[model samples]
Target: MAENMTGDIISDHRERMLNLKKYYPFFRLIDTSFSNFKDGKYEILDMGYIVMAVLRFFIEENNFKEKDVTYPEYLDFLRLILKRDFGLDLNEQDSKEIADYIFDKIKNDGRPFEFSYFDPVDRKKRVSRMKIIESSIRDNTVWYSISPDAIEFYLDTKEIKDESRISVSQLLLEKMINSQNFRGGVEVVERINEEVNRLKLKKNEVLTILSGDVFAGIEAYEEFVKTGMKWFDDEEKLFKKNRDLIAKSIEKLNASGSTGEGYYRTMNEIYSLETQLKQAMNRHSELLKDCTEMQKMTDDAVRRAKLGRLRSHMDFTSALSDMIKRDNADILVTMLSPLLKPNIRKTFDLISIDDALMVKPPRYEEKELISNERPEDIEFEDEIEEKRIKDNYVFLMKNLIVCLKKSDIITLGQFADAMKRAYGEQILRNADFFSFFVNLCQKDEYQLGGDAGEDTFLDAYLGEGFKDTESFTFAIRKGLGGQVILSDNCMMADVELVRKEAHGE
Candidate 1:
């Protein structure tokens, strides 16, 4: 029975695991189960919460494109948040010290956080490293942003606004784009590009190892090739397929011949995506060639190492063992004394030895009063707003389906008119209506799989109104329609909706 259950489970997730491993180091800082060097130093009240607070701050600052996020601002934020969130009233000096310590961990002390793990897919060791946040030199001072890996890691936890109709992609980046989940498609490709970067870094690691230690380098090179070369053929084919798809999309846009503002805006975004995709493709190709050459170079090194290629320095341990074997006990101490000598340094103690005698005895200590009563369940504004929007989604979908039932194909203009007639003109002005436009553009295509079936989040969000209608496949188009003037404040590019069976597709 256990084997039957296990048989249904999909276990090989090396690609997903590789993506997830990027965040392991960041969380490793706060995990009590794992030992970190700074664990003692960062032992603050709710250390994990504070760490997340700092990470969220970085993400928000980057979102706002703030160029002036320096240490002073960070210190100020730390001071205020500690007081507000945890009621830890710390002095200025102490606050600065804590802020500086946290900043170091967030930046990983200007070095990449590194880790190695065995990938189950290929049964090979894979090296993964990422900095949670990175800094840039701007005007001789540093400014920071959340690193790409961290951004991807954060995004991984978020569900797509419209729960993917099928799967986001059962396969690759191109399929994702084709599914009309545009941003997800772009980000998915970015992750693949990151995989290429990791492989390149792995190759360089092998070369660096080889330069110092021949045997270790040879082993590392073999492992690197084994992991990297796995994707060599698939990635090459994927790059071409994606680029061709992009070209086809571009062609479709040009073929539309619409000179609307929305048309040009979408064209510009596609152009930018095209440029980035080309760069990633080029980098991936070059990395493949470099890995192949490195493999050959490493093979040569292994051959030389087998022939007893010696490093520049003599092996100290081997020499010591030989001496001991020869029974040269008298000279052993003489030879080892200098190496084993205690590390020499100079330092002065801040506290004098005599001060210990003058230390006062402990008196009665008063602790802060603790409240035993259960705290009220907090309701966040974001959560409230999300709830409001989701409710809006249910109502809007209900009305839209009603309109679609009147006619097999419904255009945005038609739907808006029906909404204004059924509800009120004010409904057209609602932000929920505007948000629907945004989601539609992201995933302009949708269809009901069957009666009483909820294939996508859209179907579920449609409420009981959806189950009342028969099965249908509907797609919205931005290119074919003119501007949809729903309200004075809210205007959207005219979107045309067509049913799947109408075109016999």
Candidate 2:
């Protein structure tokens, strides 16, 4: 009965292997209990069939109708099956070999097993049935199991031909090259080239791998390209808008009619003041010349008197008379009584009589000097000083008008320099004149007063103030240095003043 029970178990194992093949064409039963029993040995079940059954269930469930599975997923499926069905913890290497055998059978034959089922009843009735089932299962199963080294061989060969890695690598390379980050793109292409070369892959195989990713890269590249195009369009629009605004501002400036006459008036005023200043300077030079000439005459007269004294013991009467006439005898006599010689009077009287005789009567050569007007020959020092001061004030007014016409901002330092340039050292001494200049320049009628006094405005407009008195002094000392000439509109009133000054009206 024990022998019979053993035979029954073996027959059942054979039937089970056949059924497993029909359901899972990708997996094959290698060795079963029946085959082992035929060799007169009974081994305890390892339940490898349970692993296969669960894997078959998974494949059917996921609708994986493929004839063959690749290495990685196949190995993973085997491990999953083992864990699910038998709770057997198989290591990675063991699971991989089992999966490899299954893959090989499916790849080669399109099916895992040669025999479909075993007839246990027929084995009892006909010995041939037992032999047939055992032979078919053993040959197919043991063929895979005998050389387990074949699994590794198959995997090494199959992995080389797997195009998935190559496909993904190619996709990555294409994406990187089209990316905006140019450096990163170059790096990715280099890495792809190195890897492809290292793998010893054929050009066609590499190209095929790369093809799949091309479309994906193109999609992303299109989006990036559009973004850049839009940015350029936006910039162009902004530029046009700004250009139009500037054009409008220029048109407005042209439409206003205040500029031309204003500019002319301001320029004329400046020129008139300049003329007056020149005249004052010339007068001062003339006075200096006269003083020098008078000093020379005095020296000559003294020398003549000394020479005459040596020539004549008669008290040098001719030299004394000449000296008194040259020195304004009447004033000298009153101012320097102690220095006057007693003989100087007698000599002066004789010289006076000779002067009266030599002086021709005025023929009234159309008296150049009018009775009410001062003579050109007579110079009044006080009047010259007053004219100089007036010229300086007029010059400052002219500058202020020009600056206002131009819509130019004049800083405090610039204003001060203008004053100094117009009036020289006199401006520094006259606080009232400085105050008047500031008040006049800042008037709305002059159009010189804007928001220029505000600290924020000044900081933005004027770069920085003079660092020291030397810079300020240097700025004011020259012809153009202190001038803050403005536009035509601002200088109109000043220009009118200049015209009046020119005609002396």
- Write one digit per residue (lDDT tens) for candidate 2, span 1-505: 9999887777676655543433332223343332344252223224345433533433332222312333354467667766775465767765565555444443332221333445565553211100101111231122112111122122223332333333333333222222222233333334333433333223223223334454443443344334322233333333244234334433544576557885555444334433432332343344334434533544555566557668836445765787787975564465477766465544354435534653648777575654886646644443464455545554554564454334344454555556577667455445334434344434232212233333332222221221121211001112223333332211111211112222333
Q: What C-alpha lDDT, on a 0 to 100 scale, does residue 241 get in candidate 2? A: 40
- Cα RMSD (angstroms) for every candidate in the order listed: 26.8, 62.1
Candidate 1 lDDT over 223-336, as tens digits, reads: 765556664675566567677888888788789898999787777767766776776778777777887788788888778777764557677888879878997767668778
Candidate 1, poorest ten consecutive residues by summed lDDT: 161-170
**Best-matching candidate per TM-score:** 1
Model 1, global lDDT: 0.66
The whole-model lDDT of each prediction reads 0.66, 0.38
Model 2 misses residue 220 by how many Å? 57
For residue 230, model 2's alpha carbon misses the true position, in angstroms, by: 54
Candidate 2, position 372, lDDT: 86
TM-score of each candidate? Answer: 0.32, 0.15
